[model samples]
Target: MSRTLFIIDVQNDFTEGGALGVEGGAAVAAGITEYLAEHGEAYDLVVASRDWHHADDDNGGHFATDAAPDFVTTWPKHCMAGTPGAEYHPALDTSRVDVHIRKGQGVPAYSIFEGTDDAGASIGEVLTQHGITDVDVVGIATDYCVRASALDALEHGQHVRVLRDLVAGVAPESSEAALAELGHAGAAIVESGALPTAGAGAPEDGDGEAGTAGDRA
Candidate 1:
């Protein structure tokens, strides 16, 4: 019955004025902060992920070079390692985070499952160690990382819920499509206020399959 709050890629590079800024990305960050502040005690763990891509060379072909980015499979350089853009948005109060996961170090990674913690523990290991069974997904880029993470959570056999109000996306049409996909995949598309019920710990699922979400993210 233990639950985890997954804050996915709410970094500077994804917010307004960032390298890949979404329309309401900043608002999403602020709203997530407010949600955590009001319901911080409901979860057994709070995990936050960031796109910490490598600065040297393209990240496993994630960054487009020598040409314009098509914004589909390849994108402009962003969220490089050790850069301000790689840092979480200021509005997100990371003090609530129990696990810090960093992904896309030298590769294209979309789901938080592709990430590892500061100590190099895989996300599945972290979740299992905490005995989490339910997860609430929230963060930026609804059509990308947030979608990937939620799908992965569901794939891992966990009860997954996406906090629709706490997320932003790269495009409206694609975002709506992603939400529909998640709903079809067994995830509950919920508002931020839908908290996990109070309970003890239990075993959970594992990593997810990267679909078009991974390709774009």
Candidate 2:
């Protein structure tokens, strides 16, 4: 089987010290780096998604401008296009990444596959061209971009797996919901340690129930 690894939004802006930091986000980068160091060669393809937004764009102004109503609670300006915040987290090992897919450049794109080049080919299309079949997803904010990308992968008929240990979330409740949604959508959820080898055929949380972290309010 052709296997691929999709590292989603492990950008500096989402890490612990960045503009819209998620708790434990830096740990996700460390964990994925360790995984890649050991098993990077097992995957046929390795791809990464980045949130590259322009500084003067609507996405940037949404938080600063008073004209628009505050949506999503008006997050701090982050991941602006071509800026350091928009780059991958420093701890990430990009040596294994075969393709770099830049998302959220034009609009507020959460899904990695949502962005398309002038030729109309999506990141998914690019992966398909490279013979990627099974995909393992990891990285920041499990409740948002990671979840959206995994769902999109499933919708495109690719077998998907979420590296549970290699992801952190902005909100505990939303993390639980994303996990449940991923399981419902037929995604296998496993820890990063089991990736690319031991847990390939393991059954997911087949109970089809959402689970919340105990500390979540």
Candidate 3:
């Protein structure tokens, strides 16, 4: 189907017990792993993105420096570069991920499209290089990164499907509203269970450990 799976910010900082931990975030990570175990080959590519903010400064004012975070435009310090909070969640099996995307380097970013690969290719560029016409979106903070990434995918002219069950949001109400917005914007909100078999399948453990960041996309 010339498709790709987008794994949004499923990092420690956004999961339970981190800087900006959300409810059910850890479950989403583990659920994605289980789904991939059975349907990893359902698509041609799998890409994962993480927030890798700079720890030195306020990250272009994304992180509230001296004042309390308002949680809307500004937030508490999180996902610092090279820290554990920036790494993928422990339960997510990143072994199958082919391209590792890191966003929010020194600025505020929500969409995966705003990030670049280690090779400096944007997500859209990578998808075009691979001829990706379809994408399945899943991950943490359904109302934020997941929502933004799905919208950008649509703007990129790719058919987008958001795996609802594989995502966790900052708040239930906001998450529902985000899904509605995505649907209205032309994204298909679907459950992962209803998807057809996919993936070309990659070797286990990748170039890194089974769940380590060495080869995580």
**Alpha-carbon runs more than 4 Å astray in model 1:** 194-217
> Mind giving the per-residue lDDT tens digits that candidate 3 earns over 39-148?
98777899999999999999889999889999988999999999999999999999999999999999999999999999999999999999998888999778899989
Question: lDDT for every model?
Answer: 0.83, 0.77, 0.85
Better of 1 and 2 by TM-score: 1
Evaluated at residue 153, the lDDT of candidate 3 is: 96
lDDT of 2 by residue, 8-57 (tens): 99999899889888888888888889988877877888888888877885
Ranking by TM-score: 3, 1, 2
Distance (Å) between predicted and true CA of 125, model 3?
A: 0.5
Off by over 4 Å in 3: 199-217
Please, what are the lDDT tens digits per residue for candidate 1 over residues 1-217?
8889999999999999999998888888898888887778878899999999989889999999978999987999999999999999998898989999999988999999999999999999998898999998888789889988998998888988777777888987798889889877877776654443343222232223212332122
Off by over 4 Å in 2: 60-64, 67-74, 116-120, 196-217
lDDT assessment of candidate 1: 0.83
Measured on C-alpha atoms, candidate 2 has an lDDT of 0.77
Better of 2 and 3 by TM-score: 3
Error of 2 at 86 (Å): 0.8
Clashes of each: 2, 1, 8
Among the numbered candidates, top TM-score falls to: 3
TM, every model = 0.89, 0.85, 0.90
